[model samples]
Target chain A: LAKTTQPISMDSYEGQEVNITCSHNNIATNDYITWYQQFPSQGPRFIIQGYKTKVTNEVASLFIPADRKSSTLSLPRVSLSDTAVYYCLVLFSGTYKYIFGTGTRLKVLA
Target chain B: GAGVSQSPSNKVTEKGKDVELRCDPISGHTALYWYRQRLGQGLEFLIYFQGNSAPDKSGLPSDRFSAERTGESVSTLTIQRTQQEDSAVYLCASSQGQGLYEQYFGPGTRLTVT
Candidate 1:
């Protein structure tokens, strides 16, 4: 598993776009970048995932550079409910082992 | 299409007692995993099971911690002689075939050992 580094916390305002970036300098060729959102007292929820380039879903978008060393999760029109801890995970395809690092805590204020 | 479910949502046990944490993975999911989350901390990988193969117990913290899965259905993590340090939320997740697939998680069992 590749070690990931992210900011401890970030603050955003309502209706504004928020981007959380993660750095995985030792990322492997087979690794995929995935992001998860965790709310208080609930399990982490899958947000978006991408191997390279850009992937967009109804909820969020994932932008991965060609080098794959880093990726960013972009949330459009943030709301107060969007406040949560975001975890960036670098996992190998077809493996069950996932190492979760201290994620970036996002706070969307009104 | 129920998600992963864990039992006892909360478990309060005394030191030296054994406790069991259960996990019911999603139907047809071939991979199941166990993780621990300490208060105000990150998730810690505990174990992984795929179908009927032997589970990967390398992440088990100590000899006192063990987990078992029956077929591809349910799994139980047994903590022997629980201690105060064992207090944390035990999480369970399941994926389709593994290898970077998205995993669905349960609400998790909050274990408090006093």
Candidate 2:
């Protein structure tokens, strides 16, 4: 399993774009980076995923550096509802096992 | 279509007792996983089952923790001789397949061991 490192917490104002980055220096060639959003007392929901370069979805965008050692998750125009724990995971394509790190707790302030 | 469903949303048990948490994965999904999350902490992988292949039990914390899945349908995680540290939310997720596919999670079961 590839170990991931991310910020412990972050704060952002409403309507401002927030970006949380994760570093996985030992990422394998077959690994893929994925992010998940979790609310209090509920299970996590998938946000976006990427292998290389960048991938954008309706809810968020993922940008991976050329080395694939680090990736960033960008949430555009943050809202109070977007305040939740964001997890950056490196999925091992061989076994498909996910090793989740202590995620970044994002707080959107008004 | 119903998403993954876990029964006994909340379980309160005493130490040294045994408890079972159930999970019903989405129809047609071939991969199932169990995770434990303590308050204000990240999720900890528990066990994984894929099709009829032998489960990967490397993540199980102790010998007292075990899980079983029938075919590709329901799965049950059993905790024997639970301890106070066993208190946490038990989450279940399933995907069409393991590799590169997004997992759909169900509302976790909050287990409080007294």
Candidate 3:
């Protein structure tokens, strides 16, 4: 079973910064939080990943608290093209049992 | 365009028919994975293959679903007697020997069982 949970849907404006939070209270020490973005009719794309602290990439930023109970994905200057499903996955690298939780659908309005 | 690729972008078949989906992972990726996605849902893990190690088939929903990958290369997912519930997008991904590497996904095969 997937151990992560996030909002079902969210809405944002084109130029606004969007923040989506995921809760994984039972996250393990070896687990890493990875986020993926999927557009309609396309496979999911890698966004950002972090274990603790923060990790930023060209696409998005992943912020994980010290407790690792939750993490947030921040997108800056969102656009209509950014509207898609965002998945938060908790992966145990040792066991490799990667499960994708139901994603947060972000609809960007112009 | 060095990325994963799957065959038969769209396949429509009658119930009880068998279907084979193929996946070609990135050139040097040693870890390949298969997943299923229903409409407006997250991916469901199907199988995983790493190098020459035995595939982890723990996620296969039923015995009718089976996948094979040869020497960390092209992989094939074969479903016997496909059911209507099998109608979904089959996605394939690959990473460079796993371990904290992000998986790269393919366009996926949309299977519709009529």
Candidate 4:
């Protein structure tokens, strides 16, 4: 089952910071939260992942609280090319099935 | 160093005909997965394979859908008596490990059933 839920869509302007939050209330202790960014006609690309605290990469950052009930993906600066669907996935250690909830459509406007 | 690869980037078939899709996961990656995404919809998990263990087919919509993984590399998803509803983009992914690791996805195969 899909354990995460995110907003249907969001809009942002160029050079703005966009934060997309995902809620996985029943997340298991062993589960890890990962995020992927998908562009038109292409596969989803791994952006960032985190178990707790925060993880920052060249492209994005992932922040998770101690409770792990929810997580946020932060994109520092937005551009027109950054417009795509962002998916939040709950990855279970035992089950290889990556449950992807309906992702948030991010539109970066100029 | 190659990522996951899938065959026949696009396919169009008659409603009653059968079709086969192939996926070649990253070398030495222990896990492979299949997912279907329709237009304007989230990905729907189809199946998963890890190592030599049995595959998890719970996500498959019907018995006509079956997949097989050879060793820890190549995998194939076959659909018999395809229906128009089966039209969607089939995506393949693999991870070095499950859970704690992130999955790398391949360019999906667009299937159009008529």
The top-ranked prediction according to DockQ is 2
TM-score of chain A for each candidate? 0.91, 0.94, 0.92, 0.93
Per-residue lDDT tens digits for candidate 4, residues A1-110, read 44678999999999999999999887778888989999989999989888899999999999999999899999998899999999998865455557786899999999
Question: lDDT by residue for model 2 over B8-97, one digit each (tens)?
Answer: 999999999999999999999999999999999999888888999999897899999999999999999999999999999999999998
lDDT of 4 by residue, B1-114 (tens): 488899989999999899999999999899888999998999888888889989889889999999999999899999999999999999999998766667899999999999
- Each model's Cα RMSD: 1.7, 1.2, 1.3, 1.5
Q: Supply candidate 1's per-residue lDDT for B113.
A: 97
Model 2 per-residue lDDT tens digits across residues A33-76 = 88999999999999999999999999899999999999999999
User: What is candidate 3's CA lDDT for residue B33?
Assistant: 92
All DockQ scores: 0.78, 0.84, 0.81, 0.80
Model 2 chain A: worst 10 consecutive residues (lDDT sum): A89-98
lDDT of 1 by residue, A20-45 (tens): 99998777788888899999899999
Cα lDDT tens digits, model 1, B7-114, are: 999999999999999999999999999999999887888988888889878789999999999999999999999999999999999999776679999999999999
Provide chain B's TM-score, model 4.
0.97
TM-score of each: 0.95, 0.97, 0.96, 0.95
Clashes of each: 3, 0, 0, 0
Question: How do the residues B1-114 of candidate 3 rate in per-residue lDDT, one tens digit apiece?
Answer: 389999999999999999999999999999999999997788988989999999889889999999999997999999999999999999999999765789999999999999
Structure candidate 1, residue pairs in collision? A93-B99, A94-B99, A95-B99
Using TM-score, give the best candidate's number: 2
